[model samples]
Target: MANREYLKLDRVKGDLIVLEGVEGVAYGEILEITLDNGLKRDGKVVTVDGNRVIAQVFQGTQGISTSNASVKFAGKPLEIALSRDILGRSFNGIGKPYDGAGPIYCEKKYNVNGRPVNPVSREYPRNYLETGISAIDSLMTLIRGQKLPIFSGNGLSHNELAAQIVRQASVKGEDSENFAVVFAAMGVKHDDADFFRKSFEGSGVIQRVVMYVNLADDPVIERITTPRCAMTAAEYLAYEEGMHVLVILTDMTSYAEALREISSSREEVPSRKGYPGYLYSDLATIYERAGMIRGKAGSVTLLPILTMPNDDITHPIPDLSGYITEGQIVLSRDLQQKNIYPPINVLPSLSRLMKDGIGEGFTRDDHDEVASQLFSSYSRVQDVRSLAQIIGEDDLSEIDRKFLAFGVAFEKQFLSQKTDEKRTIEETLDIAWDILGILPPEELERLSPQMMEKYYTQR
Candidate 1:
């Protein structure tokens, strides 16, 4: 019935297009705009106040003449084209399939934005999404329906680690309805895009993957919408299609940068580091979209990667990100400088949902113990290193001697891994075997007997 009525356009400004005379017009109304060329562009209401709404033109409003064009609001928000057909496909920041593939064979389109999982709707995340990596699974375990951010600095190998997790992570015995990785890369270059494509294809995980890219050469404004579009598609597949989805957002710094650019274009008031004031809530809108919705057969997990500008955690983007997301896996600049591959600095890194996702039958019984032990050992290594700088490694105590070896084993064993390598939960656990070798069996009080016998090979 709402489709029969229409509202007239009041004005159009930079990033803000206004419509007049419709109290309760609502936010994000899907509309069809008949442009001059007779091509109807599909757009949505972006901002609304007392019936006046502003819509962002996804296709770029070049020839959209006010007098010529008619608007038809479908009385709803933007929805995505989603289904099994979305698999192995590529789309722009908006959800229009562009891989030379025809229209998606979908049931129906759903709203791009949806409500977050209610506190009552949330079930305890007991199932472990085994990442097949020692550093992650054995220490900072990733749980299903959890938001775990990867904190990486510029020029680090975070991208490679993200890609590998997509390839290697899965749930045991649930092979059929396992992971579907929704990878969104915003503001990356053509070469970076190509590298991800090639790496994903070579790994043969491209089939279960849906990628929405806003490259460096593309429209910068598109970056803000890119993750939303990817999540839109992800939501459809995970909930409706009944598949566990892992939504990866690489370089959220790029997304934030795009936001700053648009805000500057509009001459909006800037906040810290020239970012918008509502940056935290804006990020929460995306990151919180990930979770297990009540009664839904599938879940959407998030692993958003952010590059701290100048490796500064205090930077607005990574700072607000730390506040919004559950926990972060911080990659170390010093370890990277030492030629370590992942260089995930263990002490600072944490997974808040680790306890909920590990232990008992989910992973091994000894998982928590081994993880805590590793944390203690590595943390002491830092203390030893600082003292060594003051008094040297030679003049250290017996306990300090063990810490030195633990530090080396941590880097060579825990952090470094072949990019081409894919380890199972067992193999990753085996690396735990080598790291625990530095401390004596009595000092390894955290590990259980089966774990000690299986992993603690006597030196």
Candidate 2:
């Protein structure tokens, strides 16, 4: 269909503009709204009902008048130009270059609303992706093509942790040249955006990174498009260029809030916590995009971070995310109070795919045994600490005292690491062994006789 123009504007509601007598306008189709003063704005068709349509202006509807505004349907959805040159470039929330660089010279543009990968074409994710953090690498190992999210709260150090992962993450035996990162920040402040950029640039990893930033002051509608743009670029690089892509979307809560705002504007009924009813399926569209296709040479791994309100894990955002994602890495406020850098509370954290990704051919043969022992020992430590609080510490038994000491060493040495410190898988496992040795031989039941003789005895 040819592009159509309409001079009728029914009303302006919040950031949305309604039009009557609009025909052949499809959902998600782009629109060009020109004001009487010749200032033009971009919008997308959000809701259509026969001859009536509702669209959201990308800039805003502040000065749009119902009598003078002109609506022209672009007959296309929101799209971004994709190419291998997108690496190391910075773009706005809508995928327009903001790095002082000119436009991307590309022959093809991809729709930001990507199609879901068919379940039949998905390959089972295997092989660990190392983040160089002991708490993550040894415990909740991130597998290629897995979607593992970080559950955090306000004022925590998740930003630093995210930047650190981007700088240090790598795949075992994979060439550094084939590894790339796509970082997207939604509803972030100026200072926070600067921190991410400066951290990556200072670490000299910006060359392999693609950044998409949507500041808090920008239009809230743009937040919904930020991650989609990042994912589009990632798919292009991973599937077309054959490069492994790690997509990190920080503060997904902001994106959900944007959706909620639009839903409210459209008078849609709200679900849990005043969010839209389709929160689960909407989130799935983004999270489900991470995987390896059967015939594809590369994969896409997602590490989405969301801050929980009042540290409530049962809140709708994190609750729904846990259901869709493979696993989560939870950050502990209590650990942060103890001066831990990453502050990962490993007790509640897990990686469902770690079993298939580690041991024998992948990581070390002892990786599985060592990880199990650490989990069991740490769980015992928590029980011991609780018991000591009820009774006096001086009255505790020798084994109980050993458990408390092991807990301290585990947190201080194993879980906590400098922001810039990068530990190899071997080094992380070695540290686990050193901490586990504090327990008596009887307490190390998670390890087999062979692993005990090989690693435990040597320690």
Candidate 3:
């Protein structure tokens, strides 16, 4: 006969949940909690074997014993923190305030493990999100209520790029619509967290910015929920408060690794490359949350960052991410090695929504033609580069040599920018003209004569 003993889990110390008769018991889905001394707790389902279940506690592992503690399962995963008050507030992964402001005076919360939204109810993403960066705006335009990822490698400046987007992204002024930023970083270093905090404050967007951070030193379990909590807050702000939101999740790779670790700890069967079997579905839950809901006044836009191992675009992280996201902004290690600050590889970077977001009224009449011309010119420059290497520079034709120079100038001028540099749409367009001036006016058949006069420089 199997003996059953009821156990009481009293507290959570860091990641370890303190309970009776179970030490080091892994916690799963966090259920509802009633706080002691007004300090709330979240529950998780730690183990399930042959109908026997065990859970670990969150918050602290102090003062819990067999006789005093009590627990009940709500038959669901941890409820997500979903409310309008989540913004401008900081929380650990388990939805506890690390900001020291105390418990949220809110009327509600929701399941953190989001339910699958009905596909038929999904609204098409039509609105535009204007990120001040020209390459992104002109080539890979970001649409409102879209999910995009920044595929970067080690030593890449994805953080700075993401920060720039958060600072600059807005909607067209015609409707006078504006958006808010919800930036969350998982498993980031202490200095990085401080940098982000200071960045939002210095930008004066801290009032509108909602930040959820799990430091590198924070328990891995926290990393798993940081982005989810951030999204939950974003959902509240956008869907509830009628605000457009740009949610930036830097280092999703860390989030994935954390999930894998938890899966291993729980002794779940691993799948591709030792990742959890449900990695795809788990990601879909988060990514699918960003979109326009039918009858909702606001939308959620997502930009997640994932660092590639050894600059491998084919790696599981970026590879799987590419399948899920609308498109990626690929950072170049070669460019970084060359001392390019931003290191954006424009050719490889793509914004799938570019076609829908850019047009005459949206940006300018020449936007499409200009972008195609730049793309064509840059791609051709690569051929010229290879030829230069083969035949030696002295053996190249005048035009071929000029094309090579243009490539170098384009990378250094357009792609590379100092971290502090901020350029408006007008400034970026003018600079494009300045660089295009090196090519003959006859070669620019993409633009009309009127455009040539208004935007082009006459030799």
Winner of 1 and 3 under lDDT: 1
User: Which 10 successive residues of model 3 have the least lDDT summed?
Assistant: 1-10
lDDT of 3 by residue, 227-258 (tens): 88878777877777888999999889999998
lDDT of each: 0.79, 0.92, 0.74
User: Per-residue lDDT for 274-331 in model 2, tens only?
Assistant: 9999999999999998999999989999999999999999999999999999999999
Model 3 CA deviation exceeding 4 Å by range = 1-5, 8-28, 31-42, 54-76, 80-85, 174-178, 445-454
Winner on TM-score (2 vs 3): 2
Task: Check candidate 1 and list the clashing pairs.
Answer: none
Model 3 accuracy (lDDT, Cα): 0.74
Best by lDDT: 2
Deviation of model 2 at 320, angstroms: 0.7
Q: What are the per-model numbers of colliding residue pairs?
A: 0, 0, 14
CA deviation > 4 Å runs, candidate 1: 1-25, 31-43, 49-53, 61-74, 175-177, 263-268, 445-455
lDDT-better candidate, 2 vs 3: 2
Q: Best candidate, TM-score-wise?
A: 2
